[model samples]
Target: MYQFNFNFEEFLAEYWQKKPTIIKGGFKNFVDPISPDELAGLAMEDEVDSRYIAQHDDEWDVKHGPLTFDDVPEDHWSFIVQAANHWHEGAAQLITPFRQLPNWLMDDLMISYSTPGGGVGPHIDQYDVFITQGSGKRHWRVGPKREDYEEEFRHPALRQIKSFEPIIDDVLEPGDILYIPPGFPHDGYAIETSMSFSVGFRSPKKQELLSSFADHVIANEIGDVHYHNPDLPARQCSGAILDAERQGLENMLRSLLDHPQLMKDWMGEHLSNNRHELDLIAAEPQWENSEVREFLTQPEVLKRLNGLRAFYYPETPTVAYIHGERFTLPSECEQVIPLLCDHEEVTGEMLGEMIEHPAVIDFLTQLINQGYWYPAE
Candidate 1:
């Protein structure tokens, strides 16, 4: 039971939802999730989403990914990579430690390496991001949450500005962390050759939130309540029949939504679900379920998956939802769910404590049955 030595608990208590706070040199011996060469290598891949912003002479040039510096004019552009979290094992590891929340509530990390005068311009992201200054220096300008959000059609020649104004501006050295809440407009430019790791938490929008739930219902994983059509004949005319049907459908949906567990179900499925483009690195000859259980039973051995994160949406008092493998867990062991979620070191001591609860042990046993749980090398 190694608690985080960092003041995350104090931070969550004081300023999580309040104004943004800066932690001067918060990360100690913080290594860049990946090196510039590694990022460049990933950018050269055709499938990954990467971009570069060439901003000089008051003009901007932007290009999409699987690109190298040779792909663009190599003067003043900075490399911006998306879904870097998915491709790079280290970038993914950077975020796994923060799996206190559900996976659905979590999002991917983006990283960039920039030359002098390179920047993406002032932009507002739809989700939250924790920008870490990895190497060199970047000047970050931040603004407050603005009103009057403007949506443009994204003209090819025009610069798109999201709602953000510069309220705070400073130079970020290595290990300096900048936390930006959603809808806060901010911009960063490199003072020199700088690298930044953006750890983001992208919560769902209204449409996405609704669609995810709808998809889950259609999949028949949750909301077992049947949409019973009243077996009444067409006594009324066409107009009356349409109105009655609408009312019945609406009422049925409302009833399903009215359950106290509806939100929990949605959160669970969302958080515990796997990320896109999962790269499962297998080891040695495949072992059977029996071997998996035997491996898990070892007192000194620990079972952890490489490049995998497990998060639980622990909303209900009786059960929890784990991401990646997608399974239910005992609510009593909620205190330990994050250990698995972070994809960090998991100790036999922690498992022993959790297995003390018969239900939790049973659930983990089922995971072993599925070969999702593996012993650490």
Candidate 2:
């Protein structure tokens, strides 16, 4: 299943970011993560968010629903469901290979099924996503890019759909993939029954960027420079802060962003931190004096949780951050970081004679205590 084909990796390395490239027959032996019936069942459930849009001739009607297979009108229009990443483990498995991408960069998987003539119309996304064509055919119309987009008020809920004139139009077959970079306007219409797994990546908007920046301003004393107060009348009731105050505030803000550590910390938190659990364990380190060589060298195993992300943060110095919690390890333990980043099961024997390293033993103990990675008891 992990066979990396020459062409696939080549496409990723070369044309992934530069241009749009379609890979035909990428998922060999590609058993679907979820069957069409299973997905249809998910659509029927009340807790799941699902919607369908139909186009009869030129008229487009969209409706939100707890849609079942029966509610669908035999053909013609697109059905979209969101947050499959949160609900269906099977749907989520489609994205398992890309875990090499940090959770910060990787967003979520959204699988959509389109019947004949079904499409969401020409639309543009601000974030990068890979649309993996599954099961049937979908015709895609993609433009190089036209960012000066005009959006009109359609529904108060969704942001207005973008109008695009496609430069490239082609029908994608099963096991084909379409990579659409941010700002590219494209639309996909199903020629027959089709399923597409959209692997999306998160990008921060201006407001989110500003919020994190503001947080960095207050958390660290990067913005603590005092504002100069010129001598003024005691009864001054100026609504705004004076020139010196403004300059000081501007300088502080600049200093906040200018702080070398600001972007680094923000990136670490943004990328390494999971949207889910990151519980920090409070247990004290236990292997400092104990010669646990036997314990480490024995048939020991490290268990990996489903959503765990174990990354070594160089900035945090002697700490390995896993699932957003900081686990401090000894300085000599740096080599052990890769072992954790492997994100799969590893035994003491596979860890080899390096188990003699006190630092490695200590690191394993801390990991076990944190439950970020646990011993296979």
Candidate 3:
């Protein structure tokens, strides 16, 4: 377990999404959970979204991977793997401490291996990130939040920005952490071969939320009430939609969202669905409920799949949204949903007590068979 040596509440109040700050020795005597070689292997997987950015002749280039080891240049290159937490258990542990943030907002653990002179160039991210140094050193520069920075593209694939006056210009060593809020221009280059674990918290854009909610409403056959004018007032101009008419139209849409149950359902389902793929391997031969119960009797650990987002709203205690699906949990097992949602590890003993209830046992069996939770190897 990694010890996060900063006061989270203080950080949230003082710096989160407000400014960029460096926390020196955030993880004392830090040891990298995943190595460069291991990260390279994951990048070679077809399912994994991996890319390398290289610079030559003052021009940058990018290549999407399933790349060979030979494809990675010795210097002036950086390899980045998105959602490494999903596939690598060790890498997943790095995100555990950041769980202090809301689970729904937590995105993924993006691991990167950079060679000397390696960097993606100065750019702004739309999401907040905590970049933790794992090994070696990196010179990081972060500029104050600015809206007018123009993008200067070195490569078609890389969206970099013109250089800005840096508010933070420092070299980070092992255990150091850099907290950067959204829209802050920042850049980092490895002084030596180094590893960085970035835990990102992304907020949904208004358009994205509206789009997703619309899809949910359509699929569920809700929010289909048509606009009606029971009392039609004669208008001076037929072409003009009256102010009352416009307000009514807006209210009609707002009313749908105002419905508490409807909003909760959409919020649970939509937020629970992660954009990235989870590392899931379904049980080869599906286990029966009896087999599931039998397995749970032992003191073995059952781990939730890494990067699997689960959420339960306090308003609807019995319902849980796990990976885009809602499970109306049994009343007897209401407490179980929070355990599953909030924690990475769930021991068999934890569920063993709840297994006496058939509904609970069946739910556990379904979860295990579906590969949401698996016995720890």
Residues 1-377 of candidate 3: C-alpha lDDT, one tens digit per residue? 88799898999999998999999999999999987889999999999999988888688988898867675567998989999999988888888898889989998889889999999999999999999998989999999888899999688998999999999999999999999999999999999999999999999999999999999888989877789989979878999989999999999988877887888888888998988877788988998999877877887777899999889987566788998999987676777888777788886666556868788778878888999998888
TM-score of each: 0.75, 0.73, 0.96
Best by TM-score: 3
TM-score of 1: 0.75
Model 1 C-alpha lDDT per residue in residues 266-371, reported as the tens digit of each score? 6566755655444444444655544534554676454544334455544433454544234555556766566565445665566666645656656655544444
How does candidate 3 fare on TM-score?
0.96
Name the regions of candidate 1 deviating beyond 4 angstroms: 1-6, 56-58, 71-74, 83-89, 96-104, 149-159, 162-165, 221-249, 259-266, 281-284, 297-309, 313-343, 347-349, 353-377
Q: Which candidate number maximizes lDDT? A: 3
Q: Judged by lDDT against the true structure, how good is candidate 2? A: 0.67
lDDT of 3 at 189: 95
Model 2 residue 13 CA deviation in Å: 5.5
Q: Model 3 Cα RMSD, Å? A: 1.5
Of the two candidates 1 and 3, the one with more favorable lDDT, higher being better, is 3
